[model samples]
Target chain A: MKQRNEQLPPGIRGFLIRMGQIDRRWIYLAVAVAIAAPMLARLRFPEVPGRMAQATFDAIESIPPGSRVLIAYDFDPASAAELEPMANAVLHHCASKGHRIALMALWPLGKQLADDAIRDILLEYHPEKVEGVDYVQLGFKTGNEGVIKLMSTSIAEAYAADASGKPITQIPLLEGVRTIGDFQLIASISAGTPGAQQWVQYGDSAMPDAFKFVAGTTGVQSSQLLPYYPKQMEGMLIAIKGAAEYEMLVTEKYPVTRSADRLALGRERMGPQFVAHLLLIGLIVLGNVSMLAARGWKGAAR
Target chain B: MSADRAQQSSGAPKSDTRLWIALLIFGAVGIFAGKLWRPGPLAEAYVEVVTETRVLAEVVPAPTTQGTSTDVQSAETVAPTSLEQENAPTTRVWVELDDPRFKSGELRRVEGVATEVWDERAKVDPKKAREQIAALESDAEKLSAPTDPTGLTREEFEAREAARMNALKVVESTRIVASPRDSIGIWIAALLTLGIFSFLVRDNPFYKVVESILIGVSAAYWMLVAFWSTLVPDLFAKLAPDLVRATMLPGLAPSEHPGKDFLLALIPLALGMMLLWRLAPRGAWIAVWPLAVVIGTFAGMRLTASIEADFMAQIAATMKPLVAYTSSSAEGAAAGSAFDLGGTLAGILGVVGVITVLVYFFFSLEHKGVVGKTARVGVWFLMITFGAAFGFTVMGRITLLVGRFDFLFNDWLGLSP
Candidate 1:
């Protein structure tokens, strides 16, 4: 490669070499433009529900209406940008189906995120639903997976009271909910450890057939979780693409009359994502081309 | 060395010039483009709802000739004493009332339920007042012990009691009128974001300041959250339920086995205090005991969990038949025509991939024969997996960047798209 570069004219060879070593700031600017331009133009492409997305939808839809469902929020504000869309859609889906919802958190900040979802999605769309009767916030407990383990045996022991300090015994929704086994379905919107994986190990493993489980995870965390899908986890949604696809399926079935944009966050975010992926692909290709060019045609072929 | 220094000094000016020119171009282009695509006047995404405040108490119906009237009593009928209001348990509820501010026949649900309404305060539930007041008096007596186990001084204890009393009173009645967007908070967030982004150009004091603030705030925030969420609920509440319920956690439910729970909780509390002793001038070694316990307990828990969840489950999942078949439909299964080609190929590929990857890790054989070829195949499979992972990571990172940009444009600049 050095010999070939030396053989070429200094200007052309230097340019070719420089292509790989261009200041990273320039690339950052290009990315910014790629993302911002599409966002400004509102370039959204229609999302078609994929296999995993359809499976996720079916997981929620198959559950009997008014069946007890627990949604464990396991991500904080840091991962909310990626996970919130799916969280909103899933909450809406469950509420629209009239499933008795119970919200809890493994991550400390997860409770705040759950509160945001309840205020923005659940209460906004389903105003007629009462808090203690139709839904309840068990809030954040200190123990990570230990909470799941305890809940697996006895939920009343795990959380003595709801977020508001209301005793679990007094909560009408939790009348018969002695254990995690009482819930018909469980969904974990998780980012890392003490999350969906913990739920699967401690909660699901305790009573495998007691409840159906589904998970929504960030793209980076998806690889570690893929093996559990379709078996241990009945459905899985990976990253914003999965969220967008799932949102399409959910909104089609249960459309909101007001603030429809709240549910369209995932689809709206895909515009920038689409352009940014293209830009990344272009950069990857350019990088490879530069390498090949520096090697010369004969060397590249070899 | 002198010549190299001279060359570097000479090149610095050119580099600086290039950077400035690039910045100018970007700035000019961005401004012009934004102007061209400007939607309209800036609009805040959140709207303030105007609401009025009212305190309603749940009163027991009076007995009548035909039985108690099931109707809820008017607020005027219930006039509880200040002491009763201060000590009684309360539940906050929102009631939608007629307001001229709302559209005709449209009721605005104020205060408690909706996010738009603000300053919805707790009102005492008179029904539970007698029991709660008795519990409070009992708890106060328990707290008035000779030695303060919680390590609070007399002044602090008195202050806490005063705060507790204040917390129980009906909060000030204030109407939430419409106001402008929270410009101050938005500006602070926007400036900090920009400061962080400035590092891409070059490290500067602005970036350093923002970095320090973020680190300090996050550390303090997490500490407070942990103390309240973990220590208070799990340790302190268990040990002194009455005191905790009265002072710190007003909602702490009555423990069934208070004596047993207190004894068990003491173990952790003692260990925690011992761990904190590291900050003392002497006896720092006490911290090591808890440290060992933590590590040992963690290791023991992880061993069984990992073996079950990751090791055995993965192995079981991977051990699949190469020649796979799936039932296409009920009719097709009845006719014995459910040989799925895709499923078969996928099964074969999965098995081959796993085997080759394992072979690559096996170092018993020399790399001069078919073993080397199989190892190379494994390398290909490994590379493909890594490529996919890298792609996903890149996608995730880009999404975060998109989120930041969204905040800047939509929230900060009030740009809609």
Candidate 2:
């Protein structure tokens, strides 16, 4: 390393050393371009479905038609960008399969997110579906895992009324639903605590084999849930990539022609992702090179 | 100090024009290599390639009704259809526009004010409220079985209970209109997003303002949710009956499973009151009782839950067959050979990884010789996991950044896709 640094011209050596200490603003600009360029260019890439995403898709597909599926939307607007695409794709697939959606939230703002999904997917694509009869919103309930514990025993105890203050008794879809076990499947698109982990601890452990459980979570949270996948969680979708892969599978099976833009969102978003990863790799390489050069210069001076 | 100054002057870093030229060359070459590079045959043995072309078909918009469908089928009338046509209407209900039962009017405001006064009275003269409650209890004990739970007659209680249930039913069926969105809200959100992103440049007043707003809003939101969901509904509505429930709910007809909800609610209500009573100078020590109960309950629940779910469950899942294959060739060995070998190796590695990682955390057993080697292996496993986690974190952060850009460009700016 010392010999290589000495062989290089003084100007180049100085330049490398200076680049090592360059302002972070330049790095930020590079990142912005890395993300924005692909999006602007409409860059598209082919996604080969991963095992986890494939498992998530299969878990939902295996459920019988018109079967009740509890979607615990345990995220807020902050995480919407990461989790929403998968949420939309999953909901679209479920709707196509004619599943009865029982929407609930453990987070406060999660109720609004559930409503957004309902409005964007359910109300948008499947307009003929009635609110109470075909789908029901239990709204946001506090108490975190305590709410899940209550629902495991009795759904009504936890959620007395829907988000709009409608009694659970009046919901036609919830007529025979007494406990979490009544549902055929439960999918939690979670960002943090009182999320998939809570569902597994409270709901799954309470009544194992009663209902299939799947999860879609942020990438950072995936490691925590990794041990449970293909076991406690029959399926898992990690982050945006998982969302894109799962979207591909769903759209392939049940294509929503007019809503192609909505369905293609996850895949479309992957373009920026690939570009950003490349940029990160470049930054890491350049950073290391700079470090080595600086070290060599120090040693040569010594 | 003189030696340090001489050293700094000799090896001082300086910017040069060659850096930009070198960076441009490096970037161009890197891009070219990325585009052109392919794995060798050896790499192909461990890699999988899958490619497909897909076309998104255009859907003809179905002629949907503009207004509410007049031919709406009642939930009772629509029979369950097969999975063939999912769109077929399965269930619907006739929602009356002017439903009388939903007239649970602005009675809650009156109840709120009354409850505040009653709570203040209870707070100021606890002994008086206690005696009044004891007298009311004695009067209730003297009354006949069917008289009434409170001071009201059985007939009046029943009638009020029915009315309250009706009001609840009406409120339940009510559909709220969607809140309209305007450009102002979008602009505010955009500004906030930009403010947050500004931190990447440098800490600024804009970022501070956004951060402060977020902290303030989150605190206020939690307080509001706690009040409505827990304090008001669970505690205040149940305990301060005369002021809130009697006036607003008007005798919330005892739940079908009455004792459970009422008694279940009572414990927390009393505990919450004790927590509030800690504000008093005299019985401040009494606060520890509720605090202990909460701590004990939470600890017990979390302990059992974490032990079972995070510990035992993970171990059970990890306990997989080392060799995944049929015992005999009659079950077909050739077709399953590859999968079996892969699964067996993975299972063995998983078990080893878990054990070594555990050993790495075992500070009691000094790492030397064989233990040192194993611990070193454990470190590698940890590093690999951390690396993967870091990569995923990068992906997550990038996705968020992309979302912000999408908002600024698409939603905020109306940029064409």
Candidate 3:
């Protein structure tokens, strides 16, 4: 490929080759503009909710109001951009339906993200709900899937106390909750390993009939989870696109008295996403064109 | 990483002075814009109340038309006087109330049925309240002693202490005031995000500092969480003698004997200590035993879980009826094809994709003739899956970029489209 670039003509052929080999910083700048410009312009696009997201929403909706729902916050800040929107939206939906949430985290930083979700979404919108009654923060437990394994058999064994060193027995919401089976539904918003996969194995597979399970995961992680969709996993929200679509469904059904930004972060973020994707596609096309043009010039030279 | 690598690459910038100056200017603009940014109007639901004002009781018993209702009425009547007496003093002592309603034997029987009627409401069936009352009584009994005097049953004691430690402080009234710390947090977050994104231009000191801080924070945070959440609860609390635990964490009530999980907890603690032996100058080979245990455990768990969840389950799901003939379909109608051609075709293609991909992976046979053609088809399927995955990955990265941009523009700059 390098030799081919050098053999091209010194005029346009040379320029095409140079374009193909342009500094990565320039591409970065192009991407930044592509994303920022669309965001600034407030470009809105319609999203058709996918089957997986619909299934996820349906699963949560199917559960009786005030049912115990265990939400495992399993991603860090690194993947928060991809996972948090859906996490927030899901929490909002759960809270709106008056579900008792048992929030836990597998990753250390995931606890902070969960706290953010609690403070921003759960607390902000649903101030009427009392902590330890409406919801309980289990915080981030170490041992990864080992925590899930312990939780499946006995949640008390896994977490003796809530995040703030409170006993689980004292939590009003978790009154009779003994194990993961005690919950009516389980939702895990995850990024990588020790995430949705671990939950599926320990929480779903271990007790398939115990509770319904759903996942909101990064786009890259979605492929790994596809096998479990609507089977082991009742529903799945794939990345921000899924988050946006699910948000639309949720807000349309159960509107909240909050800023549109707070209610629809995923959809709001999608504008930049669309433009960036277009830019990427354009770059790919340009690279391909440059490659083909250079090849033709080299053939003529030969 | 880029700074070091850029030095060896042809794309290295001549100087970073301009970049630093630009970043400083951007930072200034961000801080100034953030100061100008005002929070949106609070929802009508957000009613402010002073911190010490306890307006409404947190939990209200479910309305019932039975003996339980009578009991609730009596409790309500008596509650104000008792609450006033308790609240009279500036410093209130946490008291465990003894419910004289149920005797010990009756309480145990009711406790046995608690889990069964946990989800069922007492309003529907009055008998369910017996279980609830039993649970409430047991909770009170557990609080009788937060710490075990003897080393026989610490689990119950610790649970009570955890509850006591985690008790929610009752507030007189509620307020949802937006704190100034929140705005400062946004500014810090925006600045950090900018510092990290600055790498897109070129590796700079700002990015390096933020990156280093992130790494350090991550390590420290992980250590803290692991120690507090796992080592304390699962290992130390389970294996260490009550005296040691009491001495180490005086704030925490002492638990009795580790109970049934003591041996189970000890094994892992020993293994972990052995794993740490690698830090020693000599006999570091002892760590291999624990390392092997960890690896073997993970490998075994992954092997079984993946085969069942990922492999077998996937294959089962893929093996769908090629013809989707519903019960409602007419006798003459072409099975599944008549109702949903798209679904039927998709099912067939999925089955084909799986077979061809499997055949392609089966390299024991030579790639020639029919096998070669199938292999080519398999390659096409693989390419499509990869392409889709690549698209998703790109979307994920773009979303991250968008989130940062949103913070910068919406939160920091207060810019609206």
The numbered model that scores best in DockQ is: 1
Per-candidate count of clashing residue pairs (backbone under 3 Å): 0, 2, 8
Model 2 chain B poorest ten-residue lDDT run: B40-49
Best by TM-score: 1
TM-scores for every candidate against the unseen true structure: 0.71, 0.65, 0.65
Badly placed stretches (over 4 Å) of model 3 are A1-17, A55-76, A94-119, A122-186, A192-214, A232-234, B1-195, B204-244, B251-344, B362-373, B407-417
By summed lDDT, the worst window of 10 consecutive residues in model 1 chain B runs over B68-77
Candidate 3 colliding pairs: A167-B162, A167-B163, B53-B172, B53-B173, B54-B172, B55-B172, B154-B256, B324-B336
For model 3, what TM-score does chain A reach? 0.91
- Clashing residue pairs in candidate 1, if any? none
**TM-score (C-alpha) between model 2 and the true structure:** 0.65
* Per-residue lDDT over B145-178 for candidate 2, one digit per residue giving the tens place of the 0 to 100 score: 3434488888889887676566555443332211
- Whole-model lDDT per candidate: 0.78, 0.74, 0.74
**Candidate 3 chain B worst ten-residue window by lDDT:** B117-126
DockQ of every candidate: 0.71, 0.67, 0.60
Order the candidates by DockQ, highest first — what do you get? 1, 2, 3
Docking quality class, candidate 2: medium
